[model samples]
Target: MVSTIVWGTGNIGRAAIRAVAAHPALKLTAVLVNDPAKAGRDAGELAGLGRRLGVAASTDVEAALAAAPRAVVYAASGDLRPAEALADVVRAIRAGAVVVTPSLYALYDRRGAPPEASEPVLAAIEAGGGSLFASGVDPGWANDVLPLLVSGLATTMDAVRCQEIFDYTTYDQPDVVRYLVGMGQPMDYRPPMLAPTVPSMVWGGQIRLMARALGVELDELRESVARRPLDDTVTTAAMGVFESGTQGAVRFEVLGIVGGLPRIVIEHVTRIHPSCAPDWPQPHSGAGSHRVIVEGRPRIEVTVEATDEDGNRAAGGNATAVGRLVGAIDWLVEARPGLYDALDVPLRPAIGRLGRRGV
Candidate 1:
């Protein structure tokens, strides 16, 4: 069995641990954490699994690697310190462990990254004879891999568009919500005459991945952002934890160009307040849903409708994203040694079934 080490105890880490523990082909050997408070506690308990797995959380990365794990899944916070987090993954790879992470912005656009960002990591993996892959839920799955999968069913194609629209009313992470939806500010707020860069850091690679997959070299890529506040106070079990009036909304549009001309348009909508639907064909009109439209000789559309148990859209999105990552672990291990994006991997739905349930 392949021995695995899971780093982090957050949402994604917990889910990955649970999944790894139950997989028949893999063994959960260790769990690494930065928090000293969590050290020595059972991994299952930290993940709310209720049972004991005999494996405890520890901050000692070297000790975890000494156990000779076959792979390491780094699911730590990416926003606060991505470079540091990526460095940790690189270290694990150099120690003869395959590394997979969801950290780092612009992972698909390696051209835009500084040589210091990925070169060392790639070199270390090669030196240790290992592999590394970085991907996010929306960009990794829906936009890049999913579109490529759907395109296989078509005879010809013209354009591909993927969209993620979710209500952020139940999202409680202040930094993430603020970064994604442009909260804590007025809708009409503007920079002092200088054009501000929209939050393309979240999904810019999704657009670039699609362009590359279609063999379309983009000449230019542009982003536009729109923000608004809730007209009325909205409360939910998850949102109730946060003070009211702190919620806001944002819309992001990414226009992709081929041969100096616009070709693909990708949009993402994140809102913390209730509002009217936009002028487009949405599956649920107002409720949280994601849709992908492929405009070609044979049109194809796929819609994903997900509702949180507590009706928190942001929580549901996070859960789904974690689930997808858990599902990709096995395939990630089997992939070739190199820096890989989501489109570089084969993402068949059944790959998820290979892992344990919660993973």
Candidate 2:
């Protein structure tokens, strides 16, 4: 069995920890936390497992690597500090551990990433003779893997559009709230979109992944952001941290082109406050569903309605993500060393259950 270490203690971290703990092919070795205060706590308790694994949370990277884990699941914080988080993955790879992450910001399109941000990690993985791959549910699945899967049904293709819509109201994580809806802050406090030069880190690689998989070479990419306010003051458990109601909805779209011609359009929406548009698609107003429309000779339109087994809409698409990650771990370990996106990897259905029904 390959011994594995899990990093972080947040939502994805917790889900990954549970996945590692139950995998037959993996041995749970350690849990690493950046916070000094969380050090020495049981990995299981930190993940709400109730049972202890004899492994404690830690901040010392070298010590964790000294334990000689075969692999490390770098499920750390994914935010503006993605480069820093990837630095940790680089260290793990240098120690001879295969690293797999869902950080979502690691150089999806190598050309777009700053050399300072990406080169060191690639160099370390190369020098260590280990492998690294990053992917999340939406970018990993809906845009890349799903589109590739759908392409199998077509004899010829022209354009592909992938849309991911999910309700932000049920998601209670602060970082998630901030990343999706820009909650707890005023519109003026929002960062400026840098146009074609730099798009939001979230979907840059996703757009590129889709384009490359569909055999479309993009010449130009454009991004636009739109927002709407909440009808009234709202409250939730994420309150104080992410004040409810004032800022209700936000949408971000990226259009990819080949020779200045549009080939793909990727759109992301977050609605914490309720609003309606006449053009918005039905069933939660473009929330809680993923639609991929392909225009080609065959003209295939596929709509994947994401819902829990009980039929309630899931939040953040994390279940699908965790399931895919758990299923992909074995393949990721055997993958060649270098940076890779979803389309470069293979994902398949599996019997190893990882996600909790209610969470």
* Alpha-carbon shift of residue 98 in model 2 (angstroms): 0.8
lDDT of 2 by residue, 203-300 (tens): 76777777766677778777777766555566554344334344556667788878777678777665554442223443443347777878787898
Estimate candidate 1's alpha-carbon lDDT, on a 0 to 1 scale.
0.68
RMSD value for candidate 2: 3.7
**lDDT scores of the candidates, listed in order:** 0.68, 0.68
- Evaluated at residue 143, the lDDT of candidate 2 is 73
Report per-prediction Cα RMSD to one decimal: 3.7, 3.7
Clashing pairs in 2: none
